[model samples]
Target chain A: MTWQPELDELRAREAEARKLGGADKIARQHAGGRLTVRERIEGVVDPGSFHEVGAIAGQAEYAPDGTLKRLTPSNCVMGRAQVDGRPVVVVGDDFTVRGGSADATIREKPIMAERMAHDLRLPIIRIIEGSGGGGSVKTIETTGRANLPGGVGGTQLYHYTGANLSVVPVVGLGLGSVAGLGAARLAASHYSVMTKETSAMFVAGPPVVKRLGEDLTKQELGGWEIQTKAGAVDHAVESEAEAFDCARRFLSYLPASVHALPPVTTPTDDPARREEKLFTHIPRDRRRVYQMRPIINAVVDQGSFFEMGRMFGRSIITGLARLNGKPVALMASDPFFYGGSWTADACAKIIRFVDLAETFHLPVVYLQDCPGFMVGLAAEKAATIRLGVRAMAAVNQTTVPWCTMIIRNAFGVAGVVHQPANRYSPRYAWLSARWGSLPLEGGIEAAYAADMAEAEDPAAKLAEIEERLNRLRSPFRTAEAFWVEEIIDPRDTRRLLCEFADLAWPLLTPAPSGLRMRP
Target chain B: MAESPITIRAEIGASVWKILATPGAAVGEEEPILILESMKMEIPVVAPHDGVVVEILVAEGQQVEEGQAVATFRR
Candidate 1:
């Protein structure tokens, strides 16, 4: 028997599903300056590469004669797609379909999307909008009952979130207003991006909050400024297009999953390439503060730094960068903020950054210049020391090869946290590295407080004490004691980091598989 | 309504390293008024909002204490 008529019926159903939420809803989505879910999926993944798994799983109707009438497709459109030629699982929420709310799609759809990535050990990208296919008040009216949460998809969601973190890189992009489950999906990612204007992530929307008599706009409540600063979101861009670009760039550095090492492109930038500005950016004066970003740019492959948690912890700059086209996590102290001191937030930022490196099996390169956990009553109140020690635990947990370069002030406990303490870090280099239990500027005053008070001239005694202590605090003296390993020129940073990457990858490949990428 | 001048204060005790914005230069929120060197660390005195620098109260090499005015911006 010929199957042409049945094939024609399948073609018709596919076309209806492709129509998404129909013209009116599509127009409304566009009026809000938002791309439809299908458009977002196309924009994020490689063109024409999305081979959808469940294209017709939504509401359907039939005529009295059983002739097909209409179909409203499910909000979650997920399947295998290539991101920059690497295979990945892409899950896009169609906001036009009841705002991707829980009423529009079965719980199994999005959960299946997450589970597909987990079982296959593939990188998963979630294009989230409108509560992440979560709750809708309309459900109560439709179902004739208001049901409690936790009975549906909760265990699978948890398992996928944790499994995805350990086994593969999960990316979440907020292209529109997201709340409840939507916000949870975005926050669960290794990297998350949100569009500044069209997207906001919150527990509930404005109308829902009106019940409490609170007046707030979505932007005011959970916009880029609030979510990013809270560290709930990793990056925010000016537009959805920028968010897509960020997701693509983020996945480019990671391997398909944690079972293999990250992909390395053929080196175009010379491994020995060095910039002279590294010397200029690092000021010669001991008391002066110089820009650190320029130095970070100069050392890594040109334009390779993809910074994370920039707004939350300004003092410490953490990002993924490539050394000779080999993926690596790069952490640098930004002297511009907090003199690169490890504030409570900065320490938390460290915990997350190191976790990303270890989970993804990327080598870590630290450009350390921290004085210590910040000193003050405010610092103590913030529990900076407690968070700082937690950061040390995260650093110690890093099984991947670590290379630390003491750019300047490596003083106190925070200084020692630069490299994993469990093993002899493969390469610990110093460029004008200065280290001590505490800075001589503030330490001498406490030790010699009595002597200075008793001196004939307090100012002269203070100066004498400082001069004596400063001589002893030199990095050269430490090197002579074999406390530090190498003191290299600033220009040699790129070559050294490339060497470290070269050393790291081989050790990584032969290791056991089936471990989770610790988020 | 006429704009008022907002003084940018030093949050930490420091000696001014560089005057980042000259008088009359437009500045945005969190933009540095000047780079301050203190305890061998560089701290920036940030502007509170979009404004034009009306005056620089602290000069290069001048020591400033916490709460000392570093610059005045017309907002």
Candidate 2:
């Protein structure tokens, strides 16, 4: 006899799972200016490439005749999908179902998705909303008890969430009100993004936090502005569509996993291209500040620079770009903020970026222009020097090839980290480069105080000392002493960098370092 | 008023060196509205979007704390 009746039942349940959270709940989701989980997956991955798992795993109700009446699908919609034709795991929370709370969750589904990414060595993208199966007080009522902090399989959830970082690339997108475990998922990613208009992330949301006597709106509490400025999230976009675009672009610069080299695309921009503006880009006046972003855009492959955490670390710019079709990490100093000094926040930003580059085996190109570590009481309170030491250690321990160009000011201990010690790496200095333990203008008064005080005309004596020191400050003097490396014309920057990229590509090996990525 | 005006804040503690835009002046995105002097360098404060300057709360040579409102604008 044929088993066509059972086959028909299976098809019917799969169709029921496709109707996520019913029509009324989905309308409410749309009314709040957010998309459903299935829609989000479709927007982020390649068209018609999603293969959903556990489609029929959910609560089922049966009638008195021993036949199924209806099925309510699980809130976690997870599956394998392709991004730019590369396989990846996508796990999104269905906010239309029980507000994506733990009460309606099948806990094994999300854990299984993370396990799949870990075993298969594929990138995992988390589209977080609501709590992402985190704790809900309603769960206590449903089970008739209050359990411990970690749910039945929650430790495994956290384990795979963290272990996947060392093995493969992990990205997270905060698309709506996300709390607790959802917030942790977003924070524990190689790159994370949030929409400015529709996303808010926090450990606990407003209602619970209101008991602490702070009556604040969701936007005021943990909006895009607060999270991005606090360095909890990397980017904030204007819309969900833009957020998806960012995820796609970020993956383009990285490989599917640490076991493989980043894929190289055909070069559209000429490797020998050089801009004449670089020759006069740095202002003649030492006190003036010039834009650094344009200089970065001019040197790398055209329109390939992707900057991250722009709001948090205002002084240092960290991003990824391609040179001669090979991926490389780019770091530069912005003179507009504290004269490009290393603040505590900037140090933390650099540490994370350096770790990412080292883990992925991407060569680093640092455009040096640091004045020093930030000075004064605020700097001390923020522990700038402690973080600076940590940054130095991070740079010193990196095994990837490094190339540095001294574009402008380089002074003090912060400037000494242009390249790691005990390593022979390529380094270049421009005609405008000036470096020392301290800048000459303010340093003269501190060093020759006695000489000026003893002179009959102190002003003239000071001027004489300054003139003599200025002549010795020329970069060629350092070049003659062999203290600095080769000095080159600014117009030759791109050509020389492209040559370095050619040399660097052969040095990158895909063998795993056995070191876990620090989140 | 179709939308609320956006207030531009001083990002660092500095004295206003120059005010480039006047009240009711039309400015393009990223055009410098004023300059601030700090850390022996002149830093520019630019418009967040293409907008008209509606008000100047701080004048040239005035000392401004970080996060102080320096100007207001409408898109």
Best by lDDT: 2
TM-score of each: 0.90, 0.95
Model 2, A333-418: lDDT tens per residue?
A: 99988888899999999998888888888899999889988877788999999999999988888888899999998999899988
Clashes by residue pair, model 2: none
Residues B1-75, model 1: lDDT tens digits: 548887777755568888989999998987887888855666777788878999998789998875588888887
Measured against the true two-chain complex, the DockQ scores of the candidates, in the order shown, are 0.37, 0.72
**Error at A491, model 2, angstroms:** 1.3
Candidate 2 regions exceeding 4 Å error are A151-153, A455-461, B1-5, B18-31, B48-54, B59-63
Q: CA lDDT of A414 in candidate 2?
A: 90
Winner by DockQ: 2
lDDT of 2 at A375: 75
* Cα RMSD, model 1: 3.9
Give the DockQ (C-alpha) for candidate 2. 0.72
Q: Candidate 1: what lDDT?
A: 0.83
TM-score of chain A for each candidate?
0.96, 0.97
